[model samples]
Target: MDLHPGEQILFAGRPSWRSILGFYVLGFLGAIVVGAIVKAVDKTGSGVLAFLVIFALVLLVGFLKRIGTTYTITSERLHIRRGLLSRSVQQTKLERVQNVNTDQSLLERILQIGTVDFDTAGTDDSDFTFSGVANPDEVVAAVDRAQRLDPPAAS
Candidate 1:
């Protein structure tokens, strides 16, 4: 993330590892099933290899998704950045932030990870979100602090 000359980062983070727990669980189970099928068919014990390859691919995808995305809160803006090689950035001024909402399923609540959605004034884009963040309440607090501490400069 690049900061402006006087900008200060209030908070910066990536999605939590726990957020990909479901993917890992499903991937492991799928690998086991595929491995068993391959072993039963070939009788060469290649099922182990199949399982390892499938599980490795799943892990790689999950790792990339988690690592490639970033959420940042600064004294003057809120930013969401995605992708590793090719990048996309979305930001809104602190003064434009109208609402900050959080969503957590029962499992997510137990895991202490959730999604934070933002509503910015005059923006029709509803896809602005910080997904799978740990301690979403802290993110909200950071936004509030940023807005409070450094009020937007007059136009």
Candidate 2:
């Protein structure tokens, strides 16, 4: 199913707030760990503060990048567009898809969201992953439907 020339959109649903929250929580934990390590080694309050500032900056950039990123399932293929400075666009045809996997962490389960990983035939470490997707079951169903409608040809 080929998407029309200019018909791309985000995933079927919006990103889960729970996903965003989890990202922030992880960022906070990372900041703490980095700060602690710096403090233990350097024994300087300024080093910890510097680590905290740097961690916060990295997290902020990641948050903005996540917000800017989008996943599009077109009639023909799945499209992922992301990044600011070094933008990347990946498109995988439905017929080329070999497998699909949905994963949910304990936190994702509580939040009712997960990530969908796409495995395309003949690809080398180039699987497409849709992160922070809401209602992963629905996304999986959609992917299955797409795959069933257009299975890959035998090699």
Candidate 3:
């Protein structure tokens, strides 16, 4: 994570650990219930094996996705970097920011985690989504403050 000249990070964080912990709790419980039903019906262990395989793959993906992602808000821009096997970096200048929004689904609200979305000027779609981050409103406020700063003139 390098910054351009004079660029300073205001807020930097990854997704909440609480959400991942909650998901793991629910996922294991659901898998146990499903595996139990499959075990009763199938004489062989094929159903259990299948469930285990799928569950493992899902966990692997979630783990990689969670660990590989980084979200950053800086004085000049909002930056997102995602993925390990395949990487993508996206940045939107603060001066171009049109709107800032926060969304929390029922579960996310309960968990006190949500996504902060950035809408940059001239883009119909959201420019960035800082998902599953804690204190989304705080992040939104930081972004607002950053956007208020007079953007440096482009060379």
Clashing pairs in 2: 1-75, 1-76, 2-76, 3-76
State the lDDT of candidate 1 residue by residue for 106-155, as single tens digits: 99999999999999999898999999999999999999899889564565
lDDT of candidate 3 vs native? 0.82
Better of 1 and 2 by lDDT: 1
lDDT tens readout by residue for model 2, 13-121: 4455567885677777888888887888887596679667977886786677666677777545887777767888787777777788999988789888898998998
TM-score of 1: 0.94
Model 3 poorest 10 in a row by lDDT: 18-27
- In angstroms, give how far residue 55 of model 2 lies from its true place: 9.9
Question: Which tens-of-lDDT digit does each residue in 6-122 have in candidate 3?
Answer: 788899988887658666776777777777778788869866885796678668767877888899989988889998889999887788887788999888888899988887888
Q: Considering only N, C-alpha and C atoms within 3 Å, which residue pairs clash in candidate 3?
A: none
Q: Candidate 2: lDDT of 145?
A: 65
Worst 10 residues of 2 by lDDT: 5-14
